[model samples]
Each structure stands twice: as structure tokens, then as C-alpha cells.
Target: MAKPIVSMINVEKWYGANHVIKNCNLNIMEGEFLTLLGPSGCGKTTTLRMISGFELPTSGVIRVEGESVEKKEPYERDVNTVFQNYALFPNMNVFDNVAYGLKVKKVPKDEIAERVNKMLKLVQLDGFGKRRINQMSGGQKQRVAIARALINRPKVLLLDEPLGALDLKLRKQMQIELKRLQRKLGITFVYVTHDQEEALTMSDRIAVINEGVIDQIDVPQKIYNHPATRFVAGFIGESNILDAVVVGRNDTGIQVGTEVGNALGVSDDETIETGDAVSIAVRPEDTLFSQERQPGFSIRGVVKDHVFVGNLVKMMVTLNDGTEFKINRFSEDEMIEPGQVIYLYWEKEKGKVLKTRNLVNTDSHRDIKGGDEDEEEGYAAEA
Candidate 1:
């Protein structure tokens, strides 16, 4: 196995009484794009800062290239940071800004020019050397920032939401550019961002952090398909979370009962017990809708709303038990309308049952298989 280029062991941080990062541990491979993904104040940024030497851990160690870097200053560490803001010197032109690191290192004048020009060309800004920082567009300024960071040829590059300042289209364009650059340079990139799509689109692996703790770490596909926790399932994408009770278990799958009046067969994770309460998560796109009744694990509901997106249709369905479920359909044949009776079903493997700390009550009338109007009314009253 290739040894990890960076490792965090039992890392913790604090802001006075608040414990920001709690015993976090991660290993980042060399020449990989690893994104720290989470919502704001989730310690993703704090963890990134610790790795960059901008913030030291209150406890534990940060190792870079197999060496402890606790005592190293930010400048002394073999890494460079590209901030959300371009942070370029207003008076300095593109060439001077990119050559600043080499100049500070006192490289020969000829070497500085050679490196600066090479980096500008790498970033596709070869002839823009004389352009002032203030004269550049947002994308141009970002490119200059990237060139300045790359000119150092550090072992790792830390990007703190580097594309956050650009507009949506420009951000998308830069995402492709950044991934290409990373591939060409073969340097470890530790990127931080809250955009799930950005992380999914660019990262080799993503560490999903929440409330200062690492929730899960895996490749984008694994993280999306097999989330380790409920928080991860809810945070990474849109999912329909339903309260379910484990009814039975078998070698291949477990049986779950939900209030939507369906007994679903779900893949087992061995964490579920016969009587344990769990939350069932199904991705919206995984659901199949039809006007006719379906045979498999199906629930009948009225389409409460229909939204036409470019390529997909979004729907909100209210079941007979008054439970609302969201579904997405991709077919464009006929538009589904509100008040239309529809059946929603998915394959057995599409639903995931997550063990919850609290066992939800599964004995309500809504949890039963009957479609009694009075029972539905009573269930609504209790809700």
C-alpha cells in the first residue's frame, strides 16, 4: 500500500468552552484530491487550518510526509494555501505576484522568471504577466492565485473554498480547470467546501464532517450509496427519511415496517435487531412512480405537487396516512398532475435502514396496513 502523505491522529480543537473538533482522525493519500465537506461551522475549515499550520490542534498530532509538523510555522511547512479571496497584492502584476515566493526564497533572478513564466503557462495565462491584479476579472484573479500557489511546487496545496467568490458558471468552469491542473501536477490537494456537488464532482475521496467530528470518509459513490450515518445520508443529498421498525431479519435482508403502510425488505448492515427502531432512507431518484398499483413494496399516495425541472420531474405525494414523501421521475412522456392517484415503489436494495438512538413508536394506526378514513383522521389528529 502507498503510505499516506498526511495523517491526523486523535486531533481535537476548541474555542474556549466549545469543543470544535473531537478526536478526529484521517489519512490522506499522496497526489489525491481530498475534500473536507460539511455545513458551516462544522470544523471542516478548522481541520483544514490545522493541516495548513494556520491553526494548531489543541490536542493530538498532524503529520505531513510522515513527519510531525506541530512545531513548524505556516511558511515553513511544505504547503501553500489559496484563500477564498484572491489575496493578491493590488500593486503587483501577474508575474511579480507568482514570483513572490521564489523571490522571498532568494532564488536567482533567472530561475524566478523561468518558474513564474512556466506556472503562468500551466494556468493558461502565459501572456497576461503584465496585467495588474486589479485589472483582472474574478476568474483571471483566481488563476493568478493558483499560479502563485503552484509556483512554489509544494508537496500539498490547501484550497479554502477557492472558487467561492466566482459566479455559478465561472465556478463550474474552474472546477474542471482545477481538476485538470491537479492531474497534471500530481500534488496532494486538501480542499474545503460546503457544496456537495462540488465535492462529488472533483474529489477522489471526501471526509464528511459535522459538528466538528468526521461523520464519514469514502469515495463519492460509496459515500452517496452507503452512508455510514443518518447525518451523512441527510447531508450529502436529498433523501426521503422515514421512521421504520425492524420486524425480522434474515441472511440476505431485514424486514422493516413504516408508517406509510408498507413492509419493506432492506439490505442488512448487521446493526439492526428484530425490535430495534430505525430510520429508512431512500433517494428521491431511486423511486419509481406509476398510475397503476404496483406489486412490490409499494405505497399509494396522491400527488400533492408536481414541479418540472429541465430533465426531471419533482413530486410531493401525500399518502393515505397523511405522510408526505418526495419522489423524482425522469420520464417526459406525460406530465404527472396534482390530485392524481399514484403508486410509488422501489427495489428492495434501494431502501437503507439506519439504526437510530431513539426507538420510534411503530404501533400507531397510521403504521397499520388499512386505509380507513377515520383512522387516517385520528392519526392526523395525534400528529
Candidate 2:
């Protein structure tokens, strides 16, 4: 196995009385894009700061290439950071800003120009060398900042919400550009972001940080489709948490029951036991609505509201237990009116039972053997 490029072993950080990070252990592989993802004040940025050498851990060790870097200065380590605010030197033009690092390192003038031009070209800023920092747009300035950071050829790049300042459109564009740059350069990237969509779109693996601990770490698809915790399921995307009791567990799957109904649940955990309290998650988009009965786990609900949202429709359904859930459907699907009793169903494979610290109460009658054939066919294309 290839050794990890960076490792955090039992890492802890404290700000006087407040514990900012708690017993963190992470391994960043070479050339991988790993994101420390969470909401605001979740310790993600503090973790990033620790790795960049700006803030030392109150306890624990951080290693770079199999050696401890706790006592090293930020510049002494082979890493660079790009912040939300482009942090460019306003006094210098693009060329001078990007070349500042090399000049400080005392690289010869001829070599500095060659390296600077190459970096500019790599960031798609080929001929903007003489442009003033103030004259460039937000995206242009961000590109210049990226070029400046990459000019030094750091083995790792740490970004803390680097796209937060840009408009939505520009941020999306930069996300793709940054992903391409990481792949082409093959440098490990440790990204920090509160945006779930950005993490899902660009990360090779996502380490979801909650409070001061890592909730889960996995590839984007696995993280989205098979969340390991209740927090992971709720944070990565929208989920309808169903509270239930375990009826039985087998090699195939487990059976769970709510106050009003019961359904089959599949768990990644093989240790699920009978009579255990658990919560199952069903994505709103994974739900299908119909007047005719369908097969698989299901529930009967009265449609409370239908909200038109561009190409998507948001539905509010209330079960007999008053457990309300939000379901999403394509706008083209004929709308079901409020006060209408309808069936909501999903396949056995689409539902997940979780054993996190907290369990939710949810109820829906399931008809596992009856479904609309046409609706089943459309599920793949729409979902």
C-alpha cells in the first residue's frame, strides 16, 4: 500500500476552555482530494489551520510524509492555503503576485519568469500577467490566487471555502476548474467547505466533521447512498427519518415496525439484533406516488400540499400518526391534490436502517408486491 502523504493521529486542539477539535485521526493519500465537511463553527476550519501550521494542536501529533511537523513553521512545510477572500497582494500585478514566492526563495530572475508563466497558463490566465489585482473580476482574482499558491509546487493544497465569495455561477465554474487542476497536477488537496453540493461534486472522499469529531468518511456515492449515521444521512442530503423497532434480523435484511406500520430495512451493519431501537431513512426523491397499490415497503398518506419548484415538485404528506414527510417528484408527473389519500412506496434496496445515538419515529404501510409498472420504469430516469 502507498503510505499516506499526511496523517493526523489522536489530534486535539483547544482554545483555552473550549475544545475546538477532538481526537481526530485522518490519513490523506497522495494525489487525493479529501474534504473536511460540516456546518459553520464545526471545527473544520480549525482542523485545516492545524494542518497548515498556523495553529498547533494542544495535544497529539501530525505527520507529513512519515515525519512529525509539529515544530515546523508554515512555510517550512510543503503546503499552501487559499482563503475565501483571494488574499492577493493588491500592490502587485498578476505576474508579480504569482512570482512572489519564488522571488522570496531567491530563484534566479530568468527561472522565475519561466515558472510564473507556466503556472499562469495552467490556471487559464495565459496573457493576463500585467493586469492589476483590482481590475480583475472575482473569478479572475481567485484564479490568480490559485496560480500564486501553485507556483511554489507544494505537495498539499489546503483550501478553506475558497469559492464562498463568488456568485453561484462562478462558484460552480471554479469547482470544475479546481477539480481538473488537482487531477492534472496530482497534488493532494484538503478542502474545507460547508456546502454539501460542492463536497459531493468534487471530492474523491468526504470526511464529514460534526462538532469536533468525524461523523463518517467515504466516497461521494457511498456517503450519499449509504450514510453511516443519522447526522450523515440528514446532512449530506434530504432524508425522511423513520423511527422503528427491530422485528427480526437475517442475512437478507432486517424487519422494522413503527407505531402505525412495519417495513423491511437493509442495514450495512450485520449486527442488527431483534428488539433493537433503530431509525430507517428514505429519501424524498426515492418515493413514488400512485392511486393504485404497489409492491415493496410503503405507507398511506394524505397529500397536504404541493409546491412547484422549477423542474421539481415538493410534496407535503401527513401520515395517520401525524408524521409529516417531504417528497420530491418531477414537475411533469401529474400533480396529486391536497386532501387526497395516496400511497408512497420505495424498493427494499432504497431504504436504510440506522443505529445512531438517536432514533426517529416514522410510519407508512408498505405494499412490497404492488407497484405501477410505468412509474417503476420512470423511477430510474427521474431519480
Candidate 3:
């Protein structure tokens, strides 16, 4: 097996009494694109700073290229960082900006010119070398920042929301360009961003962080399809979280009862048992709607509102008990009108039962056989 380019072992960071990063352990393989994804103030940027030697950890060790770098300064480490604000020299042109690193190292003038030219061309800024930084656009300046970092040929590159300053269209274009450059150069990239779509587009694996803790680490598809925690399910994407109770279990599936008087047979979670309170999560796109009842568990609801959002229609359906559920239908047909009664159903395998109580209130959960009394009382209590 190939060795990892960067590794963090039980790393922790604190700003005085407030803990910023808690026990972060991760291994980034060589030549892989890894993204640290989370909301603002979730320690993603702090973790990146620690790895780049800008902020030393209060405890634990960080290794780059198989060597511990706890005592090294930012410039002494075998890594380079690209910040969100492009720190280019306004007075210097693109060539001089990219060549500044080599000049600081006191490299020969001839070698500096050749390497700088190659780096500029590698980032597709071949003819823009003489253009002043102040005259260039936002996207052009970002490319100059990347080229400056790459000229060092470091073992690992750290990016702290480098694309955050660009507009949406330019950001999308840079995402593709960055991925291509990483592949061609075969460099290890440690990226930090709060945008889920950007992380999904560029990362080989993502570490989802929440409240100074690592929630789960996996590929984009696996993280979306099989979230280990309820927080992860709700954070990564939109999910319909329902409070339910486990009534029975077997090898095939487990029976669950929700506050809407729907007894659902969902995949069994090994940690749950009979009489255990649980929360069930289902994506809005996984449900099927009809005018009449279908086989298995079904809920009768009236379409309270329908919103047309370009490619998809978002419908808000309210049950008789006043419980509202949001469903997204991807169709170009005429929108479903409000006040229309509809039946909503989904396949048993499409929903996941979660044992983590942090997702929903346990006291409001209802039993399957409790009928109308359970629905009315539980719904009222939640309200």
C-alpha cells in the first residue's frame, strides 16, 4: 500500500479556554484530493491551519511526508498554503509574483525564469505573465495564487477556502481546473470549505465536521447514502426526520410507528430493540405521491403549497393532524395546486431508522397500535 502524505494523530487546538478542534485524527493518502467540509466555526479551517504549521496544536502530533512537524515553522515545513484572499503583490506582474518564492530561496536567475514560465503555463496563464495583478480579474488573480504555491513543489498543498472569493460561475470553473491540475501534477491536496456542493465536486474523500468534532469521513456518495449519525444525515442534505418508536424486529426489517398513524417497516438498526424510541430519515426525492391509497403504509395529506423552483417543484403537504411534510418532485408537468388531497408513500428500503436520540424528541414518539389517540396526543404535544 502507498504511504499517506499527511497524518494528524489525536490533534487538539484551543483558543484560551474555548476548544476549537477536538481529537482530530485523519490520514490523507498521497496524490489524493481530501476536503474538510462543515459549517462556519466547525474547526475545518483551524484543522487546516494546524496542518500548515500556522497554528500549533495544544496536544498530539502532525506528520508530513512521514516526518513529525511539531517544531517546524510555516515556511520550514514541506507544504504551501493558498488563502481565500489572493495575497498577490499589486506592483508586480504575474511572472514576478510566481517567481517570488524562488527568489526568496536565492535560486539562480536562469532557473527561476524557466520554472516560473512553466508554472504559469501549467495553470493556463501562459500569456498573462506580464499583466499586473491590479489589472487582472478575480479568477486570474486566483490562478496566480495557485501558481505561486505550486512553484515550490511542496509535498502537500493546503487550501483554505481558496475559491470562496470568486462568484458562483467562476467558482464552478475553478473547481474543474483545480481537479485537473491536481491529477496532472499528482500532488496531495488538503482542501477546506463549508460548501457541500463544492466538496462533492472536487474531493476524493470528505471529513464532515460538526461542533469541533469529526462526524464521519467517507466518499461523497457513501456519505450521502449511508450517514452514520443523525446530525450527518440532516447536515449534509435535506432530510425528512420523523419521530417514531420501534415496535418489533426481525431479520427482514423492523416495524416502526410514527406520530402520523403510519406503521412503517424500515431496515433494522442493530442497536435498536422493541420499545426503543427512534428517528427515521427519508429524502424528499425518495417518496411517491398519488391521488389514491397504495399498498403498504400510506398517509393522507392535502397539498398546502407548491413552489416552482426551475427544474423541480417543491410541495408542502399537511396531514389531517396538521403535521407538514416537504416533498420535492422533479417534473416539468403542470404544478400540483394547493388544497388538493394526495396520498404519499415510499418503499420500505428507502428510509433509515436512527437510534440517536439527538435527532428528535423521544417523548413525542407514538406506538403503532395506539391508533387515533396516539396521533392526536403526540402531534399536539409536539406543537
Candidate 4:
């Protein structure tokens, strides 16, 4: 079994009187890419800082290689952080910046030059070592930052939204590059980001945080398909949530009466009983819509509108009580139009039932936002 390279046991953080991270626990395994994903002010960044020794926890233990890190300073820990701004010195060239760590340790000049060149090559900045920081592009500077951080040969690398400043196209390109580099190096990475797609694209596991609490932690597919909480379902992706109450149950699943007056059959949970309120989440792509009534589908709604968005079409259907349900389809072969009534259906198992009390009291059709500012820790001198 792979040992956990980093562990946070019952971690808690407080900024003065404000409680930030609340009883957060996690284990990042060796050589795996784990992403701490959440919206602004959700404590994702703070959690990463705690691991990197940038911020100290108010309570609980943080361990690296099975040893506690609570009493250690940032530079003493066997970890390095790549910040969003790259944090390179304009006075130094790429080679100097990459060689700074080795020079600080008083390594021989010949060895420093050899390691710097290899590190630069690893990040694809081999021949550009002589170029000053100000002369490099955003993507190149990001590569330099990563190379510099890794040159120290730390056991773990902490990236705090390192691609955030790049343009959309460049950001997408760097995502692939960063993932490739991690796989090649076999180093444990504890990444922090608010972008859901970025997390899904690069993570071996994702810990979804919200309001100082972890809502769920799992791989991308599991987090998307079987979200453990209402906040997770709404936050991770676009979900059509039906606020419902359990009406009946059989051997297969439980039947729930939604606020829109439709009965939805969802996979059963032993703890859920009739009269219990639950939220049903169906992804837009999983929702099926047809002009004619389909078997096992009793829900009726009027077509609101649909917009062609690249490879797929996005549709909006309004229920009788004015709840907007969304659907996504590959093509408009059925040809839906506004004011036309349609029947909605989905596979029973696809309708994920979230049986939890931590519900976000919001409309099903809107984008979910995690409230507050992500703790912006002051940047100190790097080790």
C-alpha cells in the first residue's frame, strides 16, 4: 500500500475571531496528484498553505512523511510552493532563478549548473535559461517557477493556482504540461484551485471544500456522478436539483414527490424513509427530453429555449410551477421549440439522491457560488 505523503488530521484554522478551516482531514498519497478544489473563500488555499507551512493551524495535526509539521517553519519542511504569480525575480535570468536553491545550500558551482540545466529541460525551458524574467511570456515564467521549485528536490510540491494568471488558451496548454511533468517526476503534488474543469482534468483525487468544511472527496468521475452532498452536486458541475419528499419505496428504489409535482424514482438509501426530504440531482447531459410522453416519465414541462453551444445544444424546460430544468443534447434532431410541452426522463440510477441536511437553499437552474474571499496569505521569502 502507498503511504500517505501528507496527512491533515482534524485540522482547524482561525483568522483572529473568524473560523476558517473546520475539522478538515485528508491524506495525500505518494506520487499522486491530489487537488484541493472549491470556490472563493472556501479554505482550499488556506488548506494548501497549512501543508506548505505558510499558515499555521489553530488546532489539530499536519504531518509529512509521518512526522508532525505544526512546529516547523516553511523553509524547514521538505516541501516547495509554486505561487500563482510565479514569484520570479526580474533582476535574475532563468538559469539564475533555477539555480538559486542550490546556491543557497552552498553546492559546488559545477553541480548547480548541471542540475539547473536538467531542471530547465524537464520544464521545457532548456535553451531559454539566459533570458531574463521580464523577457519571458506568462507561460514561460510559470514553467520557470515550477522548475525553480522542483530543483530543490522536495518530497512534495504545492501549487496554489499556478496557471491562474495565464490566458484561457495558455492555461489549458499549461494544464497538460504540468500533469506530464508530475507523472515524469513521480513527486507528490498538493494543488489548490477553484476551477472545476481544471481539477477534473488533472487530479487523481479531488477534495471539494466549502465554507471551511470538506463536502466530499473522491475521484473526478465519482465526484461528478455520485456526489455525496447537495453542495457538491451543485458546486462540482451543472445539476438540475429537485427538492423532493419521499413518497414510496420498493425493493429497487424510493419514489420521491418533487416540488414540481412529479414523482422521481431514485436509487434507495436505507436511512431514507417516507416523508423524509431529499434532493435529487440530475446532470444536464443525463436528462432526456421528448415531445411525446415516455414510459416511466410523468413530468411535463414547457420548452423555454435552447442555445447552440459548440458541439452540443443547451435547453431549458420550465415546469408547471415555474421551476427551470436544463438539458443538454448532442444534436437538435428532435427539433424542440419554445412554448412546446415536453416530457422529461432519466435512468433511475443516474438520478443521484443526496440524503443530507446540508442543503443549499437556492434555485436548481442557477450556478452555485461558494461565498467569501479565499484567504490570501502573504508571500514570504521562499526557501
Q: What is the C-alpha lDDT of each candidate?
A: 0.81, 0.83, 0.81, 0.83
Q: What is the lDDT of candidate 1?
A: 0.81
Residue pairs with backbone overlap in model 1: none
lDDT of 1 by residue, 256-372 (tens): 777775646574356568876667788988877788776545578898987778888788888878878788777545446789898877776887777652111111111111123
* lDDT of model 2, residue 265: 67
Overall local distance difference test of candidate 4: 0.83
Clashes of 4: 2
After superposition, candidate 2 runs with Cα above 4 Å error = 290-298, 358-383
State the lDDT of candidate 2 residue by residue for 6-79, as single tens digits.
Answer: 88877899898998787777888888999989999989999999889998999888888888997789988989
Query: Regarding TM-score, does 3 or 4 come out ahead?
Result: 4
- Which run of 10 residues does model 2 get worst, by summed lDDT? 360-369
Deviation (Å) of 128 in candidate 1: 0.6
Per-model TM-score on C-alpha atoms: 0.89, 0.89, 0.88, 0.91
lDDT of 3 by residue, 127-213 (tens): 888999999999999999999999999989999999999999999999999999999999999999999999989998888887777
Comparing 1 and 2 by lDDT, which wins? 2
Q: What local lDDT score does residue 167 receive in model 1, on the 0 to 100 scale?
A: 98
* Model 3 lDDT, residue 15, Cα: 96
